[model samples]
Target: MNKAALILALVAAPALAEPDAHALERLVKQDCGSCHGLTLKGGLGPDIRAQALAHYEAAALQAVILDGVPGTPMPPWRPLLTDEEAAWIAEYLLDGDRE
Candidate 1:
């Protein structure tokens, strides 16, 4: 391949790669679970069950997941997650399919 093509391929590799579900789940179960409870029922943080999140918009929740609540233990995860990953986690939380 040409030099420019190789550089382009390298730049696009991450964007083209599939997201790792196990990693995402682990993040939720370990990192998020630390505060939200292993089952996400509630702990240091409020309950994140689907029913409890019924009133919250997915975008709003995604914002919280990425930016976190100021002055709270919820630290922003933007440094650790992409916006798409944050949105996925928000959807997962609202789906109530913890496992």
Candidate 2:
């Protein structure tokens, strides 16, 4: 390939890459954001951005993400999210905690 074509391909490579986190965020917005806000600030569900520190542990968050809490609007996700996906979300919450 020509140098210009190669550079173009490289610049466009990231767009072709599968973004799991972006996909997860889309899913969260679709599934979770009916309650939680788009930014996780708050809605029908408690504010994940503002309150995650007090309400969650990495493990507990993973559990809630994967299996969900009973008797809450939260639904069990055993049929949906894999354990790794749940862990990723928990880590995202921990690392991105707003307060």
Give the candidate number with the greatest TM-score.
Answer: 1
Tell me how candidate 2 scores on lDDT: 0.74
What pairs collide in candidate 1? none
How do the residues 1-99 of candidate 2 rate in per-residue lDDT, one tens digit apiece? Answer: 899999997997676454378877678766777888887777988777635655677888888888877898878877877677777777777677432
Q: TM-scores of all models?
A: 0.81, 0.68
Error of 2 at 4 (Å): 45
Cα TM-score of candidate 1: 0.81
Tens digit of lDDT per residue, candidate 1, span 1-99? 899999998998797466567789899989998998988889999888899999989999999999999999999999988788888888888888645
Cα-based lDDT at residue 60, candidate 1: 98
Report the C-alpha displacement of residue 48, candidate 2, in angstroms.
0.9
For residue 12, model 1's alpha carbon misses the true position, in angstroms, by 5.7
